[model samples]
Target chain A: MDDNLMNKLAILAEGAKYDVSCSSSGVERLNNGKGIGNARGWGICHTWSADGRCVSLLKLLMTNSCVYDCSYCVNRLSNDVPRASMSPEEIAMLTMEFYRRNYIEGLFLSSAIEKTPDDTMEKMYRTLDLLRNVHQYNGYIHIKAIPGASSDLIRNCGYLADRMSVNIELPSRESLKLLAPQKSFEKIMPPIENIRNNILLYKDERKSFKKTPKFVPGGQSTQVIIGATPDTDRSILSVSEKLYSDYGLKRVYYSAYMPVNEGPNLPSLFSAPPLLREHRLYQADWLLRFYDFSVKELFAGNSSSIDSNLDPKLNWALNNLHLFPVEINKAPLEMLIRVPGIGHISASRIIRERRVNFLDFERLKKTGCVFLKAKYFVTCKGKYDGESLDSEFIRRKLLNKMDYQQISFLG
Target chain B: MMDYLYDGTFEGLLTCLYYNFAKIKATGIYRTDTYQTSLVNPHVAITTKEQLADKMYEKIRKHLGTYTLTDLYYCFLSEKDGFENILLSFIDLCFRNGPVYAGYHTHKEVIPFDDIVGKVKREVQRYVGYVRFKAVGDVLYSEINPEFFILPMLASHFADRYFNEKIIIHDAGRSLALISKDGKHFIMPYTETDLPGSEKEDHITNLWKEYFQHIAIEGRINLKLQRNFVPLKYRKDLVEFSKPK
Candidate 1:
């Protein structure tokens, strides 16, 4: 609560806000009756910031001082911002106090490279060590894995933290070279690969030995800045697809590039961040992860970017109109989910409820499906609610509804 | 048809249901405190019988299963107007058609019951994040004004998480508090005057406000979006939303 700590918290939080990976989910930890905290598998958002982002953790940096001059980063060495660092003791103390007051689920510890990668990673490791051992904090802890840090240091921190991430920064190696000459896929990929392999190794060991400590039990994730360079949505999503399949990541966060620093290589400071593009990428990413859609399916044709006017699922449905007018009562679960507005939850509910009684148009609405959208693609009990099977008509209707909603929202 | 009135408790409601099944068909069930006199319909005052309530509880569990029973309990906690009539018809339908009737999501009787239960569960989940604790001496204290009687539902989550710390989550609307200390917890009647005034700011809260302000991006200032997530109704007790004196 001192002035020095308050100033450091303000500066460091500002530096870490752009990282945009504030999830505390994927681990269900219980307090041992002696510990002070627990982790819910479904993460809890303590509050929302003015930017509408969830404040799940006390997101902070170990220090704002940097040696690498990444053009996209506000904490680059060339920037003239206030620099402050928190000691391991200070970080641990703050995390405990905030967590005990229920202000946060846990701590999200990230840092700009100070002195060296190993030095920065070591300081972060000590903070986790003190929180987990000395304080017996059983809460969630997500720490950033420094890209160029030694594997030993990364593995040590892995055992103490619930989740870890290494930012891919740019979509492609070419963009990385242009914007951040010091950082590359070569430096970032190794830590991600190492964390993935160690997670598997630790899980297998835990089955054999119950006392084996968890190595990033919440799994590893990575982030890529959107619209930083000339990276297309296709390239970004392909990188994400590779990370999910090859590296076995839990999430791939796509951060809209906010131009905090002025550089010849970066976008203009006056240009708005491509927030809608980032949202479309997230929608496409969900389709890839949960909806069984491939990157090839999302970008089926010559289009290299996602449709900005509609969601990826709806766009895919519109493109593949030959598959529409699906029989709601007879369609398989997989086929049912492919229908627009029918999510996995509603699709399963339809399967379950239909087993007891045949579903009618009225019954399908109660199953939690968005009838307005699904009516265009599905028929219930041989009754089609849509006026026609024309995709153009449906698209216009949906777009008009969306425009109305947006106008009301602005008003 | 006669109206039945009983104490405002889950067991009392079950007892009223038992009486309706045993003696005569009732037009509706009303809580003793909230019951209004009607000129046309005769009313019967049903006494609370724990044994009869237990019998009805076991009957519901045996016939409709624990899932429906849990939903019914949550619906009772919602305290919505005309909820007793909704639950009565829902139970009547379940008894006639067996447990499968509960799965009839589109049924007229089941729809309102599900809506009320869903609202109660959503409020409990929201309060899990919205409850703000303050350090009142050695004990941590928080006050929440929830729409449902959700204090009992929130007991295990806070008790399990803060097992070592003394904590009290007060439901100011219901005048009840969930108090936990040293791995044990209980819900008891508590009033606002029991705790000191919480307007005084501490340095830790000041530090949190500072961090909250600095965490938002300057370029993407979206107060409307923020209001959508943390609505104005919930800002009454949040530390970051409070203005400094």
Candidate 2:
């Protein structure tokens, strides 16, 4: 209610708005009758921001006084912006108040590395401690793991938070050196590796024992700044694939870099954020995670960029035309999922629905399959709608459909 | 042609289904109001028989999986015109074909029923996000005018979530309220009454509006995408859309 606190809240929240990693809770924790809040597995989006992104958490920074000057960051030390810091108690109080009013699912506590990485992380840890122990709030909390924070500090905070993330802002080590002189892959990668090992260890222990006090039960994630330092989609997706495969990360967020802070290294102030590119990357990322796609298969014959005209699945399907014309009723689950416009849910539906009776084109439509693009690739009981097997024919039809439905200028 | 007429409730629909299964040939099952003007078919007024409804519900669970039972409930909740008849035909198909009916997405009888169920469930999911509660006296109150009668579906989620608080979630369109007090919850017909919001509620709401406006990045302002998620129909009661008094 204090005037000072309101200004601080505005400054801190504005600093934290660029983050896109707080959409889902991913952990389901029921209230133990005493706690003030409960975490649902599929997190609730309390409201959609004007930018059309979900505002699930009270995303705020502990302080906007940074020691490091990342080129893309609005809160870099060199930038002349209003600075503010909240006490751990103030943060906990604010989170509980917002949560009680149902304005937010929980807190997404990040910081500007005010004094040092460890110092900033410690303050965040204390805030989480205050929320959990002092306030008895058990909502979905996602806190940032400061890149250079010590393992012990990261471990201590992991116990209280549902999910933790360390943003790998730059795609490659070379880009990190060029744009963000202070950060390196070496500093960021270790905390992620440590969290993964501890999560695995805790999982094993919890299986044997009942009350292990869940350590980052929602798992860990990271973000990459797209369009910042000329990193190719291949380079970006390669890092994402590595994070998922090696570190066991739950998600890798792609933030279309907004040119907030201008520098020789950063994009021009007027250059549009590569939102469509970011969207395509997300589509490709989902393929990598869910559609059994490998980085090698995605960009065969040394292509680095994703197709601008088509989605990753359709692009891949067009390139591998020999594999298409898959019989809907007879095709296996893996093959069905690989087909363009057949998502995991619809693929499963097709598989289940076909066992009782043979699927026709009309039946496949009922299962929510994208018939426009899918008709070209799939044969329902040897009946194919697409006239030609030529890849150009299918591609042209899809492009025409995309033309009518394009929402943005990029399309 | 024989037409079955029943009160527009899930149990009433199920009771009609029971008679249809017991050698009563149904050209269609319509709500009593819907069947009143129909000229071609002879109407049978089906009473709310709890035993018959229970038997049909159990038979549905046994023949089809629990998923179909859920779909049946959702389809009934959809309240779309002719949805009851679609449910009857879908159930009849399931009864004849056994569990295989679930996999027959291509079947003429099954598609409409599944689509309605999906539509209703989708709306139920949206209401979970769209329902905004305001502090009113000792309890929180939220009112929704959703297309579907989602009060029964929304009740369990809100009860588990705000377990401690006494909350009233009113479906203004359906004139029903799912009220929770001391962890116990039930749904009943509710007429609109003036429930005064707390004095602090408006102040807190304004702060939230400020946060909402500030959070949106200036570079990305897509009204089409925002509207797709939070449609205009549901925006009337949401705090962010409300003009300050």
Candidate 3:
């Protein structure tokens, strides 16, 4: 490894330390008949990262010498910190070496603005280029696309990478202006639009050739930092819901801000992006994606923004009481997902597995499910174990529990 | 009856097993290194003879499920000493239960056996991410003593992945490997080598210098909890926790 390569890797990797996109992973790392291993899980499987993300991947930065002055970024040019840049050859070689010994099954490559926008993008493309062409590495690779890169570079990146992301640092353009003054909302939209169109083009071609080229086969995703600026979870989820609606993005990572590079404009670390707020946004976002709960259906309800005390599902279930008491044996898959404690996969599994037998909590638990909160709203063979249907009482109980967990942090 | 032993090779091992069932009392056995045997038993080193192994396969197949036998093959490749124990356990399980394992039939998907394999795979994973190698001269080394014969499983994880950088992952338990890059790998009947454990310092950065101090919020110093994740055994090998010379 060259000195420049090591330097670049250190800067960018240190810069990427703040991202929390490790949990929302479905990408399994498999070998191509030559590499070391794959990411197959077992019963009671546990994973851990530097930040307790617990999933696997060598999450690092491609470079940290950024030309853009995004106030939220540690690698912004004005900041006096050591910077490094990795050549595609160096990056690919490291990934292969680590992969052979099974340190990780994939690479999460992100970079800062170095020199011109095109130069930054060219380096990112070349890294993926070397990983694929020279090394024959057919593995999980998630690359973060710099917003201001040329259209050609963006398209080529989509072709080469398994997943691509462009961080929408703040929720609204108004907040973006206040926090990240150098970044414009307009500069962000073009890439999102281009990736969306390219994904669609690849899908269309796949129907004809069956061997049509893969373009972001793992799909596009982006992150929006929470608590960095004055954006509500309500507003953030709205933007996230729209990103999903418009671009067909696979995931929108919500990073809870940890008051790292604090200044007068930034929020205090004590009152930073409340970790629960990030959790609530993920719940509400899940509602939009899998539960088919619309933004209006979520916001127009009396209890706007998810309940701080109860989970988002419980909050919604309490708000809309009449929708509950649905039979688990009879309810549609959509209604099942809306039930508290019923995840998308479990709900679908319930629908499939129930065809042979009338499903009970016994079978549900066997398939990795908890019906603690769900029992109140759902009945299996007319067996309802929870209390009366006063939404207020349930709401109060849920809130009290949340308050207990939040304040009991000493444990 | 004569027992045979040979340098580690699947064919050689299979050949011994084959003729042991065919030529004499079908009782000839193979062992890796020199050792004593019963007065009635004679021993010799064996090599790959296709016809002998093929005939043995025919007889073993008459009474053994092909899938169960293949699993035995994969498990044997692990070169773990306790492979015989597992083999006995497997043969016992098969005779007692009639090859109820899902992998027995090519058609009926046996998920539970695969799930056990999956459990073993996780052990391989924990070994990979968690193994800490001590650097010595040009090479890095770490010794793992896993419960099962995990050498074959661990071979690809360390060697092929670290192709450019040379590293040795020794199965301290079985002394076996599944390495791809040309390097020293073996399994043996116990010998002694005083491994240099914590000799490398001043070169690698002191581990836990930043993460332990900076990870949690300022006031919450949960040493007990942190220690629980990183056990005491590993600390003895870590340079950060070493007593000042």
Candidate 4:
């Protein structure tokens, strides 16, 4: 553990930590022979940060020394912080050595503002270029899109990296203005828009040509720092919905803001970034993406914000009682999945199995639907036995049940 | 008292049932890893020929269905006392009751086998969540001596994300597991049969090096939580966090 290697590791890992795009998504791969490692289909990374994220990759800093002082950053030139940087060959060698030893799934190379965006991003790109072309490293590589760098470098990076992320760190331009005066929304949006158009263009070209262009096969994903600005859940979600729909982003990661720096107007690190609220938004986000639940139905009776006590879907079901008591035997897959205790797998199984024989509540337990939670929401053969789905009553009952379980477990 | 011994195949296990029902003074049944008694001696060992094993495997399949065959495999893997008697009882149910209980929930004979399989599944789930990896050059390395026979099918889980990397998995207990590279993989036998080092070695045994490098959250040091999940017994060949050996 030389002081130099340790410093390079620390500075780079810390710089990389602020980026929230390390997810290894899609179906997992088998560890075939001749490769250095394998992916767990269920995606098991070794450890997680306090905010519940996986750390499988050798997530580290290429360099932490920054010339530009972004308001949201602690490693800015004006701020007093230890600095370190890894050379291009050093970064690529470390990544290969780590990959060979099964220390990481791949490399997630990022850098703070080193000398210039061109020089720093060029250093970053060169390391990836070495790993890809020289070493023939084909493992997962996630690189950060250097802000204000020319589109040519960003475009070239998109070809080699498995995933590329340009964080919309602040929610709106006003927040960006107040916090990060040096950065602009205009500087950010174009790369995303260009990447989207270019990704489509590459796909079209590949469809007709023998040589397929390697254009960000995993597609582009971005991160949003939650509670950093005065943005509502609605505001953040509206932006996320737009990112998914408009720019064609793969994932819109929600990172709970950690105020590592101090200022008068800047947020303090005391109030734990609403983890539960973040969780609610993730569920509601899933509902919109997968479950066909509109954002409006989620906010029908309540105010714009998400409920902290109950899960968003269950919260919606409580208000709309008439929709429930849908028969598990005959209900559509859409409605069946909405019922609590029934996961997507169980719903599909029900749809398939019910074709052969009528499914009753007793048999539904073995059918994989959790009857304990689903009992209140669903019925079989017209058997409905649950209290009315009034919001207050359901809320009290659910919370009381949770409290009872917790107290008894503690005792 | 007589010890009815059989060959080292699953059918040889079922053959024990065939012989056991002929008499009642059955006691002290154990796998032939060690221990010899004057009563049965050792020569009477019955071997589960590939044909016989397949035949009995098919019998369970015909009467008890596919999942019951799964139960039988796990029941044999359990290494519990009187598992033979429990298995014999289950076979008796296949004969006594009809084939309705093959996939049926409310049946008499399937409960014990079901219980054993459930326990195995729990261990599987825990291993799935808790399994960690270490890189050795280009090959990722993992070693586990699980309480059950689970390593053969675990590769399907880990290979996707590591598509370009190669990995090796060793079953410290069974002495062999698997080594996969590129996209090709094969299971090879291993044993603590050879000497590495005892628990007295200093520094990481390669795996410890991997685990130390794996942690990104240095601030969240919860050894109690890690120990609770990993347990002390399974930590020996882990190489990374294990005490010098």
Per-prediction DockQ, in order?
Answer: 0.70, 0.59, 0.08, 0.20
Per-residue lDDT of candidate 2, residues A61-143 (tens digit): 99999988888899988999999999998888877767776778889999888788888889999999999998788789999
* Superposition error at A76 for model 2 (Å): 0.7
Q: Candidate 2: which pairs clash?
A: A353-B103
What is model 1's DockQ versus the real complex? 0.70
What C-alpha RMSD does candidate 4 show over the true interface residues after superposing them? 6.7
How accurately is candidate 3 docked according to DockQ?
Answer: 0.08
Sorting all predicted structures by DockQ, with the top scorer first, yields 1, 2, 4, 3
Q: Order of all candidates by lDDT, from best down to worst?
A: 1, 2, 4, 3
What tens digits encode model 1's per-residue C-alpha lDDT throughout B1-245?
89999888898999999988888888999988888998989998999999999999999999889999999999898989989999999998888777888887778888898889988998887888888898887899998888889887888899999989999998888889899998789999998646654433377888889999999998778889999888898898688898886
Model 4 alpha-carbon drift over 4 Å, by segment: A27-44, A47-52, A352-373, A404-411, B1-143, B154-169, B177-189, B192-240, B243-245
CAPRI classification of candidate 3:
incorrect
Worst lDDT 10-window in candidate 2 chain A: A402-411
Best by lDDT: 1
Point out where model 3 deviates above 4 Å.
Answer: A1-10, A22-47, A84-93, A135-138, A262-264, A300-304, A329-332, A344-368, A400-403, A408-411, B1-245
Candidate 3 vs candidate 4: which has greater TM-score?
4
lDDT per residue for candidate 4 within A272-298, as digits (tens), equals 555556667888888777777776787
TM-score of each: 0.96, 0.95, 0.68, 0.77
